[model samples]
Target: MTAPLIGDAVRAPYDLLAWLIGLWSDALAAVGDAFGIGMLDYVFMHHAFLVGGLIAVMAPLVGTFLVHRQMALIGDALAHTAFAGVAVGLFVNSLLGTGISPYVTAVVVAMLAALAIELISEITDAYNDVSMAIVLSTGFALGAVLISLNTGGLAVGINQYLFGNLATVSRENAALLVVLFLVVSIVVTVTYKQLLYVTFDETAARVAGLNVPWYNRLMTTLTAMVVVGAMQIMGVILVAAMLVVPVAAAAQVARGFREALLASVVLAEIAVIVGITLSYRYEATAGGTIVLVAVAVYVGMVLAGKLQSRRDVVEESGAVTGGMDATAGGSAED
Candidate 1:
């Protein structure tokens, strides 16, 4: 319930993000008022959109690298661990009567899990699925145990996180998501080239003197952050879809890495916006609805990609046949 956020600089980021949310919410409220939109009248709707939109952008941004590097499962792994992180936060608060945010604790634990993945990869010289599976299993099991131990009333509250609830998007949580978005965006922007090189070609990056392990750690840690942020709306079970589905859709149509990344962000934003509107109108679960909408988008993208490929093939055949016919006619005239 109490997701306290970061250390020392906490108050400043929270205030800044909260102010930004307030600014956007006010504008949205104005638009709603002008149009008489029912959902926009609610503060929770504003926060839900704020958080969901940010998650939509950053999930694919980070996911592009992960998916290309075949690390899609890392998002899922970290999400499960983040669930455990939520449990840890709740357990500590109840057992010791502290008021720390479960989200803050989730961030801490997920980052540790990120580090553990990196270390295992570095030591074993392979980033395999087995390790991700184990980390995910351990984290979820630990969370289940902790929640059971403190089953007085903690279990009831875990459902929002397990499956996500849009109405639970508090202003504080919205602010926290803003902070995460900034951190992820800034870090990725600054280290874009290095991460790109490391992602596409680790050996060349190492030969060019890039610290591969550091970038790997950074990528996973970012994934952890994105997972937890999106978990507020997408829930742990489906949050990873935001990371993978849009990126996959983009990949189907995009020819280059950056193109795919940009396209993924666009596709994801569309999914989030449409998903939110539909969920609101139909009284459905936001997480599941958004994901279903995303999958539909993905299927559309796949069909388009197939058509594009077929068009290219037909064009090539026509070009070759025309070349052959022209050559035959020229020889006959000679």
Candidate 2:
């Protein structure tokens, strides 16, 4: 009886977690049904929306640091590398009858690619972009070659991976996105100060006795994880847009680094929700739609920032003119 009770206690949290997930899933289904949207009627659409929302938050959260460090293109490089990983997984599965998920392979490959980029930069005294270019070209070339072989006949839906499709998001992938989001959020929260210090000034951080190399690796690793998570929906070509656009838009008007980070998340969330809705209505590509929305938001922010600056300048000019007129009037009266 004691052993049974202990087992039950150990299982209680897991049971509760399952119950909550079920509840949320049902709730989302109900909302979809109520909306009477054709696309939302399918469970895959729900998964896409959920995954999109999660990526919206995670991308910008990580992107804030990436943007500050001038490593924005690293996202693109990692994404292409993840594409190679996907190809490898598909090839292996087809050839050896392995049942591994492509995403698992993608994560592994992307992390390796990221480490390689860092290593090359560290060892050869090369610029970060140069290293990234080398990795990007090699990864994409491998992916293309593997895809061209196509001996496994697994290239049937390769377009979906390259361009993304709304129906391609499965429940399993959505769950994976949730896990990635939690991991990224926790890591960022825990390492916020150190990351901030390193982002602004790596030399200063090193001078202060911080482990700069470790944090650099950590940042790149986190970026790779994010790239793989996002690849399911954003596809190979446009996935990096999510990682950079929102942060750039937020930087246009943000008062500080933290503010930019928070604002970027908000902007990304808006873009995701709107883009998903629009894609559903039009039966369009989810990845392209989301990226288009993000780009629109970025342009809007840029325009708004310009207008605000102009207004500030005009206000200052008016104040100066008013002061000059007052001074001239006072002198004449005296």
Candidate 3:
């Protein structure tokens, strides 16, 4: 009886999962039928859209702090390192039949690479960019060599990692993205105030008795996690764009730090949805399409900012002229 009870307990979660999946599928189908759109017709398309939406929120969430700290290029650096990790996973699987997923290796390697970047900066007193450059070069070099050695094996699906394909997202990978999104969201929420302090003024945070180094490490680790998760849809080359572009566009119109963070997430979601729709309609690369949409949003924001500034200046000038005329007329009457 105890054995049977234990088995039932283990199976309960699986039963719930199946029920949730069924409910979600039914909802998706009903929406599709009503709207006459085929976006969720296939399982892979559903996974792609789910993961893309998660990336939209996670990327810009981390990106807001990265932009403030001027560490925008760390995304690109970690992405290259993740590419190398993927290469290693592929090579090892091909050589030893380990049956490991490249994405697993990517997360591990990217986390290690993130630590290495911080260590190198601390030990050598190098600039963040310098550390990033060293890691980026070495990582890409190793990936290229590994791919060359296992050309017949790794070359087959390598393009999907280099340039994302919405159709290639599997259910397992989408589940991983969901886990990553939850983890990132929770960590950021818990550490929001501390991170804000460190971001704006690390020295002041340290003076206020904060563990500056720990927060720095935490930030980089989170960035690596975000990179690995986003790499599924954004690819190695363009994943960094999601991190930087949305934050930049948000900065143009945001009046404060918190506003920028929220605006960036909103902008990223817009870019992701539009980009995914366009990619599906035209059969284009999802990563490139998303980045291009982000760039267009940035340009629009810039134009709006400039126009707003000009209007403010004109209004201020008219106010000053009106006050001067009123003062002069009052003096003349006196």
Candidate that scores best on lDDT: 1
Angstrom error at residue 150, model 2: 2.5
Q: On residues 1-334, what C-alpha lDDT tens digit does candidate 2 reach at each position? A: 0122124554665455445555666778887679875666667776777788889999999999998899999999999999999889888777787766778788999999999999999999999999999999998999889988884477775677788776777555565567788899999999999999999999999999899989989999999999988888889898899999999999998878989999999999999889988988888888899999999999999998898878888878866768755754545332
lDDT at residue 22 of model 1 (Cα atoms):
91
- Candidate 2 TM-score versus the reference: 0.87
Better model by TM-score: candidate 2 vs candidate 3: 3
Q: Say which prediction, candidate 1 or candidate 2, comes out ahead on lDDT.
A: 1
What tens digits encode model 1's per-residue C-alpha lDDT throughout 77-117? 99999999999999998989888888888999999998888
- State TM-scores per candidate: 0.91, 0.87, 0.89
State the lDDT of candidate 3 residue by residue for 214-238, as single tens digits. 9989999999999999999889999
Whole-model lDDT values for every prediction: 0.90, 0.85, 0.87
Q: Which sections of candidate 1 miss by over 4 Å?
A: 1-9, 316-334
Top-down lDDT ranking: 1, 3, 2
Residue 297 lDDT (model 2): 99
Q: Which pairs in model 1 have colliding backbones? A: 2-101, 3-101, 4-101
